[model samples]
Target: MWSRELEGVCDEEYELDCPACGGGLFVAFGSYGTFAAAGDYVGRGAVGEEGRAELAPADPDRLEGVGARLHRAAVGAGRTQVARALTYVFGEGRCPSCDVVFSVREQVEQR
Candidate 1:
């Protein structure tokens, strides 16, 4: 395993402008975060004459929470992920201005 320093807002608390509505987007970063995890569960079996049939997700997955991703990335990639993570990595909120629901994410830098 490798470790490195992280450079980004950790446990940050403030508001940012909404790219679409120019609304104030309150952002608060913190630890004890939640992350997206993939897992399998025992699906309920179908009963009756159809015989026993089960349904399960082929591969359940989704993006981890911003804080979790940031934390993990920081712990893993250090500054690289840290830099990108700090760029408003992820979250969904309603713009106080335009009253529109919006998701926050940073775009990949092009070389």
Candidate 2:
């Protein structure tokens, strides 16, 4: 079941840790575009490229099980942005520090 409280929280930008380097990463999909960065990347501020990795969104056609279901639900609700973010949630991310690519969902679950 989908919870309204969970939906509210899901709309906000959050953070995650890079599995390889244990660096704090800001996962955002706003004006800074969809990316995971270790430095402040919001607004007009400039950030260094040392720990910035572009998020590779999942392919909707390849999504399965819970990932597919959640993506469909968001699209059905007309929350396209959320749907896009969901793609990234199920997608892969690279650790800028270690240059290791890992599944975003799996890494989150490991923490």
Candidate 3:
């Protein structure tokens, strides 16, 4: 496998093509959360008291494992394929052309 990383945070969303329907797939990133910050309920969320928390749909089986972590890592790195921005969770997206939900990581074709 090749190494992928972005030098800095990205301000735009990245794009990829869906394998199922050749639709546009937007990339997203993960957030940082530490249990030390707030006991057991520590999580990544909006900083402001008024802004709504951003979220993404995730694989039900990988919700707490590598699959989930990979999504978060990609987001945290500020890049999905090269170097860009993302925040949406897995179940967070739908293909405009096919109207398919991003429930599985394999839906999008990696390039």
Candidate 4:
């Protein structure tokens, strides 16, 4: 089991590889919004909309297994933001480079 603390605010950016094209992907869930981008996506003239793909957050009621457990823990601890972020983390992400829709969690695990 992963630590519940991981559901906290400290983790906002994730570097993952696109499962289809093997391109570097920046997965961020913060002020910039929940999305994945191919190549550098932070600060000073970041890649435009063409390089990014929006994240589809999971349905809270349909959460199961680890995703459900993590959500419950976050909600129990009153970490609403964390719980919300988890929905994105456990949801689907499309690769802007290859157009492959993949699981955000599974990609993270692969790293």
Off by over 4 Å in 3: 1-12, 27-55, 59-62, 67-89, 107-109
* Candidate 4: C-alpha lDDT: 0.85
2 or 4: which has the higher TM-score?
4
Ranking by TM-score: 4, 2, 3, 1
- Give residue 52's error in model 2 in angstroms: 1.2
Instruction: Give the top-scoring candidate (lDDT).
Output: 4
Comparing 1 with 4 on lDDT, the higher-scoring candidate is: 4
Q: For model 3, where is the 10-residue window of minimal lDDT?
A: 33-42
Give the C-alpha lDDT of model 2. Answer: 0.72
- The residue-by-residue lDDT of candidate 3 on 4-61, one tens digit each, is 3222124223345555576544444434410001011224652332221232544444
Residues 4-65 of candidate 4 have per-residue lDDT tens digits of: 43633356867889998999998888778889999778789898889899999999999999
Candidate 2 per-residue C-alpha lDDT over 17-70 given as tens digits, one digit per residue, 9 for 90 to 100: 878788877766555577777766655774667658888989998999878988
Off by over 4 Å in 2: 1-12, 43-46
RMSD of each: 15.7, 3.1, 12.1, 2.1
Candidates 1 and 2 compared: the better one by lDDT is 2
Model 1 C-alpha lDDT per residue in residues 1-111, reported as the tens digit of each score: 011212224433333455565534343333412211111111464122222111111111244564455545655765643443444434444444454544533311100
Kindly give the stretch of ten consecutive residues in candidate 2 with the minimal lDDT sum.
1-10
Models sorted by lDDT, best on top: 4, 2, 3, 1
TM-score of predicted structure 3? 0.37
Name every residue pair that clashes in candidate 4. Answer: none
Q: Against the hidden reference, what TM-scores do the models get?
A: 0.35, 0.78, 0.37, 0.90
Off by over 4 Å in 1: 1-8, 31-60, 64-88, 107-111
